[model samples]
Target: MESTSPLFALRNVTKVFPGVRALDDVRLELYPGQVTALVGENGAGKSTLVKTMTGIYQPESGEIWYDGQQVTIRNPEDARQMGITAIHQETVLFDDMTVAENIFAGSYLTRGRFGNLDWKAMNRRAQEILHDIEAPLSPTAMLSGLSIGQKHMVAIARALSVDARVVILDEPTAALSHHEIHELYELVRRLKARGTAIMFITHKFDEIFAIADRYTVFRDGAFVGDGRIEDVTEPELVEMMVARSLNETYPKVEAPLGEEVFRAEGFSHPTEFADISFAVRKGEILGFYGLVGAGRTEIMRALIGLSEQARGEIYIEGQRVSVRSPADAVQAGLVYVPEERQQQGVMLDMPIYQNISLPQLHRTSRAGFLSTRNELAVARQYGERLNVKTSSWSELVNNLSGGNQQKVVIAKWLATHPRVIIMDEPTKGIDIGSKAAVHAFMSELVQQGLAVIMVSSELPEIMGMADRMIVMNEGRQVREFTRDEATAEAIVSAATGVRA
Candidate 1:
């Protein structure tokens, strides 16, 4: 099997962007009737590779081979004509349009009577395609009422609208339920039996081991390795993606344990997560570790009242507190630093001082107006405390690097003087140096008797920084571990729902 070449392959692909060579002579192979798992860490050029395959971006120099022939795909239509299609996690589908209309949006079938759009014929074809794919969706039914999993079905139906040979699924199970995921696995098996090549892109190990025949790994924009799924273990795959061990970096300083500072009681979202509860003590780093769709971020959002309908009660220092909104959470001495720093963390266009003081304007204001002097003073203090390297307090956040920008966001929240700070994916998108700095700052924070809740996907980061850990799977708290008990093998198994 290793000696035989695949029908579709990308040879020596090189794509260069300004200040970054996204893909440096990368290679990928997709064979007919097999599922290939495309694995990588964040910013490892997985998305760039997908774009090149879909004709969304052309490689500066590379060869795309399909059906035993070299091909040139100048646009999306060209890719489609070559029997290539993709179904993204957030596929573009119109809610008001019928499933049939979405299936044949760009290339509508037309014939009969007045040579106009034959709705009847199109509906008939759509019904056939849906049925063929084992999708129990109505062709004439409106897409608005469909669930996320159903929308994925519609997306698959649209892909099968033509004679699709290669299908790319990018994180398609990120929002699906447990049952929906099972159904999706069955669909993948059916597709495999039909001789369709599949590229399954996800961060879940369980998905890869369950559905993939072969595995390809990319790290730092270069190909690491590829082999049959059964030949290697999960830890070996992780080692390929990380290219480093737990002891490579991360500075953690243990502080004396203190009393409880924050606690959650029975947190539940209607569709996201349920029955979630946890506690953080002063001078503690409580880490939440899970796979991409395990609802960790959703729980954080609900805690800060972003999900209005989510039911949850919170406590601070043994007293019940109201957290019905962001303001309420802050007022109760709790604050959240979101994972998406550019959008939810800081005001990118605003000056560093303004962005830092914006969240605490009420406290920094006098006579119903904010004083520029007070704002600058408040920003200067926290900025220096966090070691934020900026040209000046008046420097715009957009001008700073990703790490500095993250520091500015942390400074803004710290100015509010909260008891417990929730940092979601705190070091994401930053370099290793920046991550170490963040970890050092977290240690300093806990040493000051401030409770910190750090949510991260990196196993080493969680193990290095977390005094205690909770692993969630499919919207439920499946397991918990202390610093002494946390290990890469155990955490991955629990996060992937494998029985101990």
Candidate 2:
């Protein structure tokens, strides 16, 4: 096998699973001393290619070449030993372990004839790596105590510990604050400066353009295009990924606004948000705009009864209601679609029909036993309405792709027949097509007199979909804007406390 003249390359890769071809004839290349971005919508085979490179999956037909030579990656360890490493969105660090321990988890330093663990040497090296990455933390600090950004740095340190020549970062800044994301960018630059081939994957085009040197696009499990970042525009890249120009990303519909349907007066969560007051009218989508730590999510959680100490008076249709738990809120005709679908929205192992019917099992059951026919009917109705792509209503929620899984979550909430639906980061990790679908569905729901309270960090969503928006900062509602008055500049300024 001759060296391919690139640090790493995947040629003509194909992977198949039951009822799906995850990757088909995908080609990708990573060059030393440069960052190559993998741009694609969810379920577009970007993840599959990364998995193949990391030894999680063997391609049906493909060749993985490293430093111009063909190689077989038997397992994760084999990939790591070959200098191909990945730092995923979720940091794989033990919470109970020290930073140094996490950095040198599987492979540890040893000394002496008996080969005893070398804690001092390991800690010193960990400190050096942390400093190199501009991470401010003690190597002896527990991983649990550090913030999400710091945990990511620990993952990077682990990659450094292995002397990784090729590094793949999958949505690394998904949970990072603006400042932390800039720090991560600097760290990536340092890695690239050291001649490490970097593969960056993210849904954010701004970040991709800012940091990536080259870009490769994939669509529907097939390679689309690859070229220098300077040679492609954002709109062009988006078209390549979704097979359509997203001229209207939001697809917000104009509907006649009705009387106030849901209102929260003096809503307060002791340590999270304070004095949050807002009213959402029927057929209107009230947007909540804020920065990462501005307590937008906490307010929604409180309204949905997730916060026990949430002090507030919630009124639906002029009558005050006491919401002490999720069930209480749902019974009040107010349902919440949580941001983390896998953790709070749906049960992955459960069938789609069951998940859809779980919230309203009492309505679909007779004498405490769930009526399978009723459940199926309800799931089928909402599934079609949301245009959820699935093998069948009996399929497990986890079997669906990220975008379809999100639709399932939305479908389950819609099945509850709530008058007021609160969505938190509704399209956080979904693809452009699914996002458009969800946005369109939201428009349809509001047009049908279903009031929606949408909490979002994406400015474009806030600007495009929101009829009116309330900006929060440090637990307080600072500013409110109607659709005509709201601008990205104004919203960001309010969210960051730069303007009052």
List candidate 1 segments past 4 Å from native.
1-3, 113-115, 246-254, 263-279, 286-324, 337-417, 423-448, 453-500
Model 1, TM vs. native = 0.74
- TM-score of every candidate: 0.74, 0.96
Computed on alpha carbons, the lDDT of every model, listed in order, comes to 0.88, 0.90
Candidate 2 residue pairs in backbone clash: 3-68, 4-68
> TM-score winner among the candidates?
2
Q: RMSD, each candidate, Å?
A: 5.8, 2.2
Where does the lowest 10-residue lDDT sum fall in candidate 2? 1-10
